[model samples]
Target: MIFPPDLVIFDCDGVLVDSEPLTNVVIRDNLAQHGLDLSIDRIVDLFVGGTIMGVQESALEMGADLPEDWVDNIYSEIFEVLADRVEAVPGIIGVLDALDAAGVAYAVGSNGPHRKMEITLSRTGLLERLQGRIFSREDVANPKPAPDVYLKAAREAGVAPSRCVVIEDSVSGARAGKAAGMVCFGFVAETDPARLEPICDSLFADMTALPKLMGLPQ
Candidate 1:
């Protein structure tokens, strides 16, 4: 089936940028400093595509008495490492160019904090392509799986929810896009495609297939 979406929404960490492994590494390293260490898979399962506060809350629930300032410290460490290592996902630029050439408007809707989002996009050279079109979880009362971010993104992009398509790599993000009434296409990068397939309207094995899948004048 052809999906003629007016606006294409992208998730940042695992979708647009290849930063999920880095993020999990940073989180694990920082937490280890405080005597709290988590496996990367656990981190990915629990924190990927979740808000900062939500992750902190989860950490607390997991028995870590992280102070209010812990989030700040984690951010600082993550950004310090990210500033030097973050890069765009392979094929992202090509996909973006294809979308632009097709005149399909797109925006980023992420559950990450504003600073992290800014730094990742800027350091990876994606900021210019996404300027004025980035929407963070902070922009809404709730994050992914709540649909607020995607709903707001669609509105800001001047497209109705049904006319928008969301590209995501996490279950939370895909769920949010579906809840927002948009077609959700899962981009399986580091995860198993079968795991993401059921929740996603369609699954793209790589970014190279996105334009065609979205019916973007390919």
Candidate 2:
């Protein structure tokens, strides 16, 4: 019962790397300095799988008195903290090894910028597997929830949209995968099922469940 997809596209932050909590912490801390306090849950709901510019826009919409270079400031601070803390999600290495053994082609499609993606992948040893396969939001005119990123990823992988499977951890990423006409499996590691269920084709509690969901022999 092998899945028919030619490629498996994964989201980076929460799916491949355990960086979402760190990202939220940086966001919360940065915003708090400007008197705009955001709860962790709120940050997760609004910013996960979204572009940094998008997060900055959200702050601007909230009437925060941000400097013209505030987004850069945020990126610098976040990356500085992330340099010492980035790690791969538990079980992801095994899951990727399984995919490799099965001769499955894969790529990363992330809402993060190229620099952040590079840092995370390089630091966590995922870069060797994903170096040329990573697609950033900067590569597309639109990011998650708009289908452009996933579409471009499939294209880059030489896979058809309908024959691709997307592994995502955020609601926006799942929506983007679906919009790209791919089967979207939501990773529910740091997310609640109820919140992810509506947008995903299926929800996996962790990467251990992924091979089964992908219809591989177990």
Candidate 3:
């Protein structure tokens, strides 16, 4: 609600690290193995902001013959690929630098599990900077679209929800931020604008543009 919010909370997968495309490909291939052939775009639409457990539930409902160990197995595969190839979202480091220069605090709040983030963020070289500031679904009873994760991040940051701004890349994450009573900026570089335009306080397509959007000096 104000220039230079007290805290900035970022979603991990699509917002901080560019892991969605890689993860989606893995999901699509695995789903096909189970007889549910979905496109990468469809995978993103259904699972981007949700957890792997949610994906299992949805995939089952959609006729995928997922086994009992599917979630664990898929995660192992995802973690393997992420550890080898994940990279930070372009300009994210610059954005963080600007926030640092402006003296605004930032943290990561994600629907992803800790182990997954450990692999992806580490691979992207963001884990060290985010070390203790990362809040994941494992830290809360409910994940995104429920507000628990974002609320936890703000609470732990010692900032009021009103003074926090969430950077999200999906409908579920945006909804969670709003439910947590925070202003949310949607990163639409990899997402469809129409999906987030109605939910976000603002929208940005480039990570380099985020510092200005957040009222940070260049």
Candidate 4:
């Protein structure tokens, strides 16, 4: 926790790309078709920061009775919608610009799989900006709620985890950032501040405020 971290690692779904609601809509609809109806809030509560595999496991435990091809099917559907609908989180591009201007390295670290990120990030025009700097859970042995992905991102950035600042938007993601020994800033636009406050080093609802919060020049 110092001013001007060496690296900034952002979670993808809600932090970088505004894809959570779009992704959740697909997940909710797909689950309802399988006889496991869940509200979007419930979906967020249970699956927002977890991997699709984690969703499958949890859904089965809750009696989802998903088909053998459920994971692939849902991913295909989610990717389709995201490819058409995903947008960069408001002011995120400006934040990236600020980081670039300050010469601060940044990357994406998410519980999502690489294919999912490729779809969302590419759709939102972020993939090129973050080329070769993205770390997905698929790249590691474990996902969020564990520090693997964030740690991997830090390692690849050639920065110590302690000197990295992680921007996350979910409880699991914030926990992962903290577990990785980074300064965690919970983005509260789509998540409850109460849920993140206890876990994060700080919280912000606006991407425009992030640069200042991280001690970056405006």
Better structure of 1 and 2 per TM-score: 2
- Which runs of model 3 end up more than 4 angstroms from their true locations? none
The lDDT-based order of candidates, best leading, equals 3, 4, 2, 1
Q: In model 4, what is the error at residue 169, expressed in angstroms?
A: 0.3
lDDT of 1 by residue, 68-155 (tens): 7998888888888788898899999998999889888999999987788889899888998899999998899888889999999888
| Minimal lDDT window, size 10, model 2 | 1-10
> Better model by lDDT, 1 or 3?
3
Q: Write one digit per residue (lDDT tens) for candidate 2, span 121-204.
A: 889999988889999889989888889989998988788998899999888888999999999998887898887899888888
What TM-score does candidate 1 reach? 0.95
lDDT of 3 at 73: 98
TM-score versus the correct structure, for each prediction: 0.95, 0.96, 0.98, 0.98
lDDT-wise, the better of 2 and 4 is: 4
The lDDT values for all models are 0.85, 0.87, 0.93, 0.92
lDDT of 3 by residue, 1-218 (tens): 76889999999999999999999999999999999999888888888899999999999999999899999999999989999989999999999888888999999999998998999888888889899999999999998899999999899989999999999999999999999999999999999999999999999999999999988876
Give every collision pair in model 1: none
True-structure RMSD, every candidate: 1.4, 1.3, 0.7, 0.8
Evaluated at residue 182, the lDDT of candidate 2 is: 93
Which pairs clash (backbone N, Cα, C closer than 3 Å) in model 3? none
Cα-based lDDT at residue 72, candidate 4: 94
